[model samples]
Target: MNTVTRPRILVVGAGFAGVECVRRLERKLSPDEADVTLVTPFAYQLYLPLLPQVASGVLTPQSIAVSLRRSKKYRTRIIPGGAIGVDLKSKVCVIRTITDEIINEPYDYIVLAPGSITRTFDIPGLTEHAFGMKTLAEAAYIRDHVISQLDLADASQDPAERAARLQFVVVGGGYAGTETAACLQKLTHAAVKRYPRIDPSLIKWHLIDIAPKLMPELGDKLGHSAQEILRRRGIDVSLGVSIEKAGPEEVTFTDGRVIPTRTLIWTAGVVASPLIATLGAETVRGRLAVTAEMTLPGQDGVFALGDSAAVPDKAKDDDSAICPPTAQHAMRQGKVVADNVIATLRGQALKPYVHKDLGLVVDLGGTDAVSKPLGIELRGLPAQFAARGYHWAALRTNVAKVRVATNWTLNAIAGDDFVRTGFQARKPAKLKDFEYTDAYLTPEQVRKQVEGTRALDQ
Candidate 1:
């Protein structure tokens, strides 16, 4: 009987943590030593920070999403699927392929970095009424949805319908919400110029959050500046506000204010993916409890990181302090986890994960931005430069970097081509209830329809 000698390492998800870990492992381990496999639904690592730009026509979607296959130096098999279940005791992972086929793959070592899903509350009508901005597909949908609303407003004869179509409401004032609101607002302003019949003033942008300040983690002065910038642009920056209900064409806030808008973008927050719950390990608020070394206690050869893991921040003295869920921590944790994995294989000591919080940057479209890098607060164009430069440098691929840069350059030189594809609007469901289903039946559906027609004729 022949035996496979090399220990197989399976890394789940192709986000920041999984991709960086795989990249490092490939560089550290020789092909003869161990076999590595990366499983993810998509064959790319999305640079999520710039997704708002994609929605605003400033950058193409592909530019921000880097191809995993491009890096061939890694002797890793790219498996396209999302892991649905993990039997820690049996060292097996059950994954559902893109084609909806379920396969169980046994592994010697496993790294969990499946990232997160949008955290939804039990708010009335939210699931069917509000659109989210957690993935590339969502971002693309938002771009088309916003543009189509404008197009409809221009053609509609009813004043109320036109006003409703033009009004845009963005829930949550976090980094994602702020950026989406800012960038989309700019897109509308630029596009409305082409529609001579429509007044730009008819377009209304409302940014509301339950919190008192926008991006509260960024500290006071900077957060204040951010709110001021949005207000100056005529955005209704409402604080301490919550959505009471959202319907197909209207949204009412807890403050007794009601808005009839076609667009309701939900960027409230993120929670761990449901996959994490199946691990049967200790978790902190839905995130897998991981030690400073990014390993689950008593779970041999199993490690986790990213938004799904509750990793303790060793930099803080308090035992209760856990690391903040940010791309920065996830990216750094990936490198550390890779190093620790190699150390374990070689009988070396593992290093602990510890990182200080770097300041954040909020790009509020065009030259408008708010940033605090190295404790220095900056606003306006300076902040914009920092915001763009930081994200530009963080991209994994050179091709992606250049593509994003070119897109920004082009957008600056010219204005947004705010043309609605009208493809997305034709879907039977509302934008919020949009789900990427394999059952959509594209070419296959057409073929079956034609075959049925021939049978009827015969």
Candidate 2:
């Protein structure tokens, strides 16, 4: 009897792509065929689509943070660290553990899905003053910050200080910024009730984007409709405008308007993980350029997907079109890559990734939403149902699904007490406070770590 050789497969990330791939691989690959390992900073896959809801007190962090340990199907080894670099020639990945210890991991097949970091610009004070919506902690912190502002404003006798605390600014009119602004605005609207001394009119939210349109991908009709919806709700919807200077107490806009504000949430955009740059591969707009198969053009046993790689969009005739970094695409790309990995191990033909746009959903708290599901545009209560329904259905685990459903039901019935958990209350909630973009190893550092250790043994 011949024994099947087990190949080492290393998956980097616990995001939509990495988790899906790992789950699929564990289910399909026989115990004797492949040994799978996952590397991540956290032990759970964060459901990013509904993250804004977490900020608005609609869902708990545990509901969206699907644990990797509770898997009844997967038996893969989980590494509580982040992949800082990958040395392709040596088939080695350098990782920095949560405890701040560094280690080297070798693999036969490597999948780069380290996900993305918040995109920032050269704007001054942006990092020091601006809050982010990229992580679970940031979302929770922002919620507490919003509530704290209301409490401070209600207690303050100085009108200027109260106004500054009550005024909020959100940069980026895309789905994240828009939803964040809308949801948090709703939170403040509800929270102001608890503070009887505070005036609801003092609470102002301004949503601005340098681009001419708000979520242009939603097309002209839906875009205008979404903007109008926000305007009617007392939100200042400004287009082709952005903040020039962000300060702890005030911000100056490019339109020559100086706004007194303390809360500035920046969800402008995201770039690929810096880990991709460590491969010394050519990138498309900071993301690795890959074939339709989600594999490197010339690198064997190497694959990149999700936000880390720019996978070609075969659905579009334009050669330059690459898949957008949406969870919908990332999830499907994961399934394709898993099959291809198994195929390569079995010496079978690898399959290329291909999928159609499944449409988009934008929940705006309460009974407001704008969703284009299956090319059908929906709004108001119908859209809200569709949006939340889609998110509830997309949750990977039954435990997560149940928790989210229960949270939604309870919040709708009894309503939130609007209590701030103060999880990281002492820590300043700023862009620099949450993001660790510069912590990754450079290609030279990666090669040295993998090679220098080899020379020491020799």
TM per candidate comes to 0.93, 0.98
Tens-digit lDDT string for candidate 2 (338-413) = 9999988889998888888989999998888999999999999999999999999999988999999999999999
Worst 10 residues of 1 by lDDT: 436-445
lDDT of each: 0.85, 0.91
Pairs that clash in candidate 1: none
Question: Between which residue pairs do clashes occur in model 2?
Answer: none
For all the candidates, what are their Cα RMSDs to the real structure? 7.4, 1.6
User: Candidate 2: which stretches are off by over 4 Å?
Assistant: 1-5
**Best candidate according to TM-score:** 2
Residues 1-458, model 1: lDDT tens digits: 99869988999988899989999999999998889999998888999999899888889989988988886575689778788777777677777788987666778889999888787788898878788887787788789988888878999999999999999999989999999999998889888887887888988999999999899988989999988888888899999998999988899998999999878888888888777877667899999998899988998899899999999998889998998788888999999999988887888998999998787888888899999988889998999999999999999989998999999999899868886655466663333454332222333333344455447769
- Which runs in model 1 stand beyond 4 Å of their true positions? 1-4, 422-425, 428-458
